[model samples]
Target: MTVELTTLAAIVAMAAATVLTRLSGLLLLRYVNFSPRSRRALDAIPPAVLMAVVAPTALATGPAESAACLVTALAAFRFPMLAAVALGVATVALLRFLGL
Candidate 1:
């Protein structure tokens, strides 16, 4: 089925709105000053954001996935970031291979 003009326009508008919403923070960064406290907070943001994104997925997937993520996170904490990521990916792959 073909999409109507109004529906297409609505989709375009929604896409633009989503893009702008995501970019708003970066755009505002140009006007803002980074203080020491803000810098520290920014450093913490990546781990917090990563946990937020990963936790739900792990929980939804089950214990095996959660264990994989934990192993990966711990490795990342103790070694090179790339190695940690690789550990996590490898754990997931191994788990899948084992039919877990």
Candidate 2:
């Protein structure tokens, strides 16, 4: 069906994107010389990209989302990424339960 085909196409596109990003350093090194400043910039790119992607959604959604974001950032200070994410999830759930 068309829907199934569309889903398959989306999955394929996502996979291609994942592969491209993962291999990007090797691909770029072949054609480009990375200076120290450029290397530092490249190292910062992923977090900047992540913040750019997450900020709008986290800020615009609602109080619960904002609270979860804050909780995650705070937890991240003392815990690992996975634990911080779990704390965020728990925070959203608790806030929703309390009718926030």
Candidate 3:
């Protein structure tokens, strides 16, 4: 295959994979009967996913970043998720600017 053809093939494969991943969730939901508790568990997926992604990085970074993560997590508990994220990011930026 030429370079252009190879690139095109790779792009097509990626698009196919993305489409399959997206569609699989909907397809599974159509056939699976979710109980109320199961639905609740599913609803918690996003935050659990967020913590899974964020916790490791927050822990690995230095004090300011760690503090920011705590602030963010606490703010998240007290306020809206968006507000909490904003507060966390702002706190980190300010701390970094101060050379902490």
Candidate 4:
């Protein structure tokens, strides 16, 4: 089957756009020096965004999820973000398996 010209152009354009966007972020950050406060704020962004997205779904799902979410939030304070997320997922899985 032959690829249409417009489809091939669209695919190339999207790839170019994605590469440019990523390179722009790296280039922009190379010149900027963050203050301690600004740095801390930037560091907090990932977990904050994760919670903002997860919390509502957890609350709506049921007690097992809500409890798991709490455990995950507590873990985040003591562990790295990846560890915290893993613990949260494990907690939810265990709780669900236990029929909670």
lDDT to native, each model: 0.79, 0.78, 0.83, 0.90
Higher-scoring candidate on lDDT, 2 or 3: 3
lDDT of 2 by residue, 1-100 (tens): 3469888899999999999997996787899887999998876655455445557858798898789887776675567566877888899999989988
Clashes of 4: 0
- Per-residue lDDT for 58-94 in model 3, tens only? 9799888988888887775567677878898999998
Best by lDDT: 4
- For candidate 2, what is the TM-score? 0.53
Write down the TM-score of every candidate: 0.67, 0.53, 0.67, 0.78
**CA RMSD of each candidate after superposition:** 3.2, 4.8, 3.4, 2.5
The residue pairs in collision within model 4 are none
lDDT of 1 by residue, 1-100 (tens): 9989999999999999999988997899899999999887886665666666677877788766988889876774567666777888889889888888
What TM-score would candidate 1 get against the native? Answer: 0.67
How does residue 82 of candidate 1 score in lDDT?
A: 68
Per-residue lDDT, model 3, residue 2, is 50
Model 3 residue pairs with clashes: none
Candidate scoring better on TM-score of 1 and 2: 1
